[model samples]
Target: MNEPEAGAAPEEASTGAASAPSGLSRRGLLGLAIGGGVAGLAVGAGAGLTGGVAIGRARAAEDAHSAYEFFGAHQAGITTPVQDHLHFASFDMMPRTDREDLISLLQDWSYAASRMVQGLEVSATGAVGGPAEAPPDDTGEALGLPAAGLTLTFGFGPGLFENEDGDRYGIAAQRPAGLERLPAFLGDDLDPQTSHGDLCIQACADDPQVAVHAIRNLSRIAFGRARLRWSQLGFGKTSRTTAAQATPRNLFGFKDGTANILADDTEALADHVWVSSNDEPAWLAGGSYLVARKIAMLIETWDRVRLSEQDNIIGRDKGEGAPLSGGDEFTAPVFDSTAIDANSHVSLAHPDQNDGIRILRRGYNYVDGNNALGRLDAGLFFLSYQRDPAQFISLQRRLSTDLMNEYIRHVGSGIWAVPAGAEPGSFVGEALFA
Candidate 1:
């Protein structure tokens, strides 16, 4: 996708004498008046502001052709120990009158899924690494969504569809190594490339049965609302498993989301993830951004490596997100000699060099059991959010051939442009194309 021109405006004059109210020029004002008058006529005809807003929003929504939502979880403190868990879900939709219905279905599914997992001690955080800013309220409760014990994230693609294909969305769920996969209704014949929508859900509980039960129940609710096009099921190490025995740390068994920017730190958050837009409609000014990627991992092949090699490839210890160069989880990674050793971090391995690839990654590690060859079915439901996808793509492409590439694949991908929240009585996407 072509990078959008930076929305930055020219600097304003400093002196009072030079400063003047930059009102619309005569022609511009005339245009506004004419447009408003026409809009008034539409309103007078009973079309209402909703229609006007929807029309405007439709113009804007045209930019968000592809999108995705990602969710994941981990254990908190010393809670349950037998299983580690995570989950992901994604959907792609065609932009039509049905778009609203699809969004409603997802909203309902999210609400229902949260209810099913209520009381489970799972960790979740949304939009871990992406350019998009954090929602005004981190709790997500205002949107009628639950606060994940670990993390939950939403990303928007550059456009809803490619050449009139359709809008697309993605989901990632993390759970224990043996948790059940999403049902056939959600995963049957899913196409990584052409499939327009995707959804994933996963959970972990003390009992494998409980995890399966929660997942199956949530699947029914989601599938009941929207037709499933394609899907996959897998398992991975959970926070509950002993650190030494957990396989595929972060599901890729290498430090995942290593470059994820911190959300709580004001300066860092503003620089790495959030987008500020004074020109944007009032409803969207403080809102964050979103970026979604449908990344596929080659887990069966990755599992063949020795533990030490895996650590080198991922630049972190498999058991924890610690830097291979040494540090605790969440500590700033030291990209020094050891980390950049030709045999280790390699020139292409350092994430900082990959400009335009900036985001907060909040995703799930999944495993789908061994295949006929007995190889483990493992990969990442990779979801990332950023103020823009253009920036994130630069980083992802570098990783395409990085040592990690041998263990991962990018079979499917798309982009979406998400807008900020809507006012009361207004539906999402009403701002640009009512």
Candidate 2:
């Protein structure tokens, strides 16, 4: 299908008479029209348009094109308010039996999912090297055997996953960041301890409904071929502000992702995220990177501490993600300064101990307990995509010794090698170990 143009401005819903609905609110009716039209498009595409071939094909093409545009617009809209951040983790797998069967199932699932979500699409790319090294870029030219197994991932954007009342979680808008950042993020983090198996799929659809539907459908389709592992974390105000400004922030409430390298343009993506090589294989170039982390939140213990004390430990205002030393989200943290008479960088504070370790953190905050507890039960599920994982590990280890360690835990973790997109009929990992 069609891919959304990266960074396109969102389209304003028309306010004129032709664009208005008959009886319902314009926005409500528009939501129904888009959702219903997408469902019908998927069903028609899957059945091969036997009943209304011409109509089905036309509608499908039109919807596919519009979906991408919708995604761009949706991203722009949500980025403004910085509502919520959804963090996702996925692992690659090796098929135990019947490679061809596995491929068939995966393809079927991909097609089905593409139809389910607005602006959803799938493509194959080259795989990364072992856990410790960077991925090669000669993805298109090198032809390898089909992957033994594949596991895909999808994450939602802010506010789009909510219901009509904005209270419950539901799929509403499209937030396609697939083309924007996921490939490189996957490749740089793949490794043996973290690597799940053979093939990996990383996806970011326009909205939560699309992401949830796509992943579940894909999982059902690949049930026999591979096992799926998944988790999601939601972001509060802190992480969202950092992301909207294209910077990274951490759970400890520090301006964490400040040093990240930007990939604002396609050319920059090739230089920063994708891999290219002549010595290895011609087809492996243009492949990107992957990185994964399973971070545990230390909610139970953190709750014991007073709010002011907790804020002091994290180095930022609990509400706005601003530094305790004082500044807005994107402003440079006064690492050497202090808000209170007490030192800002305490001897064992998270930011103080880890002086130089930096990674691009895209995390989600979650609340799991009941309201009776008299407090919000939440912590960050952290995910960082980088050209390497070593720096990330070092940063965590440093935090492990700091005071924050008492409140946080590293419960689950894994890494995977993500491949770049390839031409049609070419499955992921068709280059390295064919």
lDDT by residue (1-434, candidate 2, tens digit) is 00001111112322121111112222222222232212111121122113222332233332322332111112111112222323243423323434354444444433432323232222222223323253321122112211101113322222222223442322222221231222222113233343233333343322223333444334434444444444443433233222235433444444443333332333433333344454223333434334444444555566678878877765556666566667774445555555632333232333334553333333444444433665433454444443333444544443433445555544344443333332333333334324
What is each predicted model's overall lDDT from 0 to 1?
0.35, 0.34
Question: Which residue ranges in model 1 land beyond 4 Å of their true spot?
Answer: 1-87, 92-226, 231-248, 278-304, 317-339, 342-351, 355-357, 421-427
Q: lDDT (0-100) at residue 433 of candidate 2?
A: 29
Model 1 agreement with the true structure over 61-102: per-residue lDDT tens digits: 322121111111211111112222333334443344244444
C-alpha lDDT (0 to 100) for residue 304 of candidate 2: 70
The best candidate by lDDT is 1
TM-score for each model? 0.50, 0.51
